[model samples]
Target: MFSESMGRITGLVPSRFLTLLAHLVIVVTIFWTRDINVQASLPPDFTSEEYEEEDLNVLPASTEVILVIAVFVLKKKSF
Candidate 1:
């Protein structure tokens, strides 16, 4: 039932257009996140050492997350 509705919807739009739209969305998200200042999201009381340690912990995790998401997205849909 759900597949029937989705097929009808997709039938109206070319597959290439849908694929392009997905890529555009990913690019826009990356650019939008770039505009945000990470430090601005942190608490004011954070010391330099605390900030350094926080960065060390967060950077690797964030990087891994993005890479994982990109891989999943690309793998799910061949582009």
Candidate 2:
């Protein structure tokens, strides 16, 4: 179920790309055409946060640990 949810969130490659592109277009259109700012429109009841761009990165130590575990798992004999 967890894996399925992840797949749904990530979507199928090509479909995800198009969905993202459509979202980008809508955002750009709203920002460019309307004088209204997207950030300022948030509900006052909830704390609003500005969108910040970020690059995804995984820790090397974690990757190394995962790789080591994977190697051991794959090394098990008997099919």
Candidate 3:
């Protein structure tokens, strides 16, 4: 009874083992040779400095809006 059960399960072990081996070989071969890119890219440089002469003025250069007109009209100076 034991032999009959074992034979039914693994009767043709050679063909089954050969099929599994072939599939493993195919997977390993496919993973071995594939697309491989090992290069890098670089960035560009773009900068200019031509308005350095007018860097000093009586008015403040940090602010862009015209607050002098609104503030002077609403209130007067403390001094």
Per-residue lDDT over 1-79 for candidate 3, one digit per residue giving the tens place of the 0 to 100 score:
1257445445455676577566555544433332111011112332222122222221242231234334436656432
Q: What is the lDDT of residue 57 in candidate 3?
A: 29
- Tens digits of lDDT, candidate 2, 1-79: 1257444333365575577566555645553533234334434443323322111122333455555556547866531
Model 1, residue 70: C-alpha shift (Å): 5.3
The true-versus-predicted C-alpha distance at residue 47 of model 3, in Å, is: 27
Instruction: Report each candidate's C-alpha RMSD, comma-separated, in the order given.
Output: 6.8, 15.6, 33.3
Worst 10 residues of 1 by lDDT: 1-10
Which pairs of residues collide in model 3? Answer: none
> What would you estimate as the lDDT of candidate 3?
0.37
**True-vs-predicted CA distance for residue 44, candidate 2, Å:** 24
CA-lDDT, candidates in order: 0.57, 0.44, 0.37
Better of 1 and 2 by TM-score: 1
Off by over 4 Å in 1: 1-38, 69-79
Worst 10 residues of 2 by lDDT: 49-58
> Model 2 — TM-score against the truth?
0.31
Q: Candidate 3: worst 10 consecutive residues by lDDT?
A: 34-43
Q: Which one wins by lDDT: 2 or 3?
A: 2
